[model samples]
Target: MVEFAALTYGLLASVILSAAQRNSKMARPHPPLLLYLGYLLCGLSAGAALGLGYIILTRFIGH
Candidate 1:
């Protein structure tokens, strides 16, 4: 479940980041490839944290 959540969040983050890049009107310089990778990594981390939190909450709540 954690792996699936991570992948889903990573894909969503990448898509949103790429779309933001495309839609921005500022004269910003092109970002490096690593920047996109970092974005995906951040999303995965977020998903992991969320999944863990859910697990902890469920355990305490007797779900």
Candidate 2:
């Protein structure tokens, strides 16, 4: 199960990325669905990374 920190990080990153995409004038963000999909992918990745980093820190580095 994902922890609170991971969820928080994912949500924060998603919000930031979405806002950045909106404020940008590039045509790369033409499709809104793509941006939402990107957010989903990013949140999943960030959550996974945070979870793994936490595990490594607590198990090996003695967090």
- RMSD score of candidate 1 (Å): 8.3
Give the range of the ten consecutive residues with the poorest summed lDDT in model 1: 25-34
Per-residue C-alpha lDDT of model 1 across residues 1-63, encoded as one tens digit per residue: 979976887787777677567646565654666468657777767987999999999899975
lDDT of 2 at 5: 70
Which residue pairs does candidate 2 place in steric collision?
A: none
TM-score of 1: 0.47
Tell me each candidate's TM-score. 0.47, 0.49
Predicted structure with the largest TM-score when compared to the true one: 2
Which residue pairs does candidate 1 place in steric collision?
Answer: none
What overall lDDT, based on C-alpha atoms, would model 1 receive against the true structure? 0.74
Per-residue error for 2 in candidate 1, Å, reads: 12
Which residue segments of model 2 deviate by more than 4 Å?
A: 1-29
